[model samples]
Target: MSWLGVQNLGSRKFTCGHCGNIVASSAGYTRNGSNQRIYICSHCGQPTHFDVNYQYPDIAPGNDVQHLPEDIEGLYKEARNCVAASSYTGSVLISRKLLMNIAVREGAEEGKPFIYYVTYLADKGYVPPNGRGWVDHIRKKGNEATHEIASMSKSDAEELIAFLEMLMKFIYEFPNKIPC
Candidate 1:
C-alpha cells in the first residue's frame, strides 16, 4: 500500500468542554456509520462523540492521494526549477500547479477561486495585495501562451518567470499561508 496521506495526530489540543482537563485528541474517520475512537480523560470516562468535521484522516493506504505539505512544496519547486527545457506550456502548467497547491495548502474551500487564496495570503502580509491581481492576470496570459503555440514569445516567458520567481519566494518564506 502507498502512503495516501498523513495528518497531525492529536492536532487539535482543545480543553474538554465537560471536564476542565486538557483534552488530548486523536482524529480519525468514521467507519460503518459509527464514529470510531476511544477518548478517555483522567476524570471523565470514554467520550466517543467524534464529530464528522473534527475527525481528520490518517495516512490511509491508497493511490491518487497526497499529503498537502509535500505536494505543495514539490509543485513550487517544479515551477521554479523548470529551465529553458520546458516549453511555455510546461511553464504555464507548473505555475498553475503551484497556485493550486497554494490554494489547498491555505485550506481554501473547494470550488473557491484560486485568486481568493492569493488575495488571502496577500492580506496576511505574505504578499502585496495589489500584486495578486497582476499575478493572476499573467497566469491567464501564460495559459493562453501555452495554448497558442505561436503566441508564446521570449517577452512572455520573461514575464512568466518574474511572476514565478515572486511566487516561489512567497512559498518558501510563508509556506503555512499558501495552499497545497
Candidate 2:
C-alpha cells in the first residue's frame, strides 16, 4: 500500500512442491488478507501454493551413482526421488532395500534377517567396524518405515540419505575409482 500502490504483486517464480518443477505462480488474496501464490506445473500440472513472502524450498537430488550397478542405482535413485517428493517414509524403505542389495552384492547370505545383512557386512570387513552402528541406525529407521509404525521426518530422511551415499561410495564408487 506504500509506493507500489498494489498490496499484492501478480506473479512470481516458484518450484512446485508436488512435482518439483519451476514455474510462474499467480497471486491471490486470501480471506484473511494474506497473499497466497499458486502455480501449476507445466509438465505435471500440480498446483503448488506459497505465501507471498514464502521462499521456495530447495530440492535435494541426492548423490551421483553412475558407476554403481544398474539395480543398485535404480533403488538409490528411487530413494532420492522420494526425498525430493517429501515422501520420507518411502525414502527410508527404499534406502533400507538398497542396503540389503548392497549386502547381497557383497556376498552376504540371501534370505537372512535384515540385521544379518548388516552384521555380515561388518564381520566380513565389507564395512568398517564403526560403520556397523550407522548401518544399524539405518536398519532401525527402515524397520519403522517397513512396519508403518511411524513416519520419518525430512531431516531424518536427509541424514539417512547422506549416510547411504557415503556407504555406497565406500562400497562401490571409491573402490572402482582407485587405480588397481
Most lDDT-accurate candidate: 2
Score candidate 1 by TM-score against the native.
0.44
Clashing pairs in 2: none
* Model 2 poorest 10 in a row by lDDT: 1-10
* Tens digit of per-residue lDDT, candidate 2, span 131-179: 8888999999999887876789887788888888888888788889878
Q: What does candidate 1's lDDT look like per residue over 1-180, in tens digits?
A: 222222333544544434445666654322344544334443464343344434211111111113336776565444433423334455556666566566556665656665665666666554555676756766576567556665454445546556655654555545655678
Query: Backbone clashes per model, in order?
Result: 8, 0
| lDDT: worst 10-residue window of model 1 | 56-65
On TM-score, the candidate that comes out on top is 2
- Give all TM-scores, in the order shown: 0.44, 0.71
lDDT of 2: 0.74
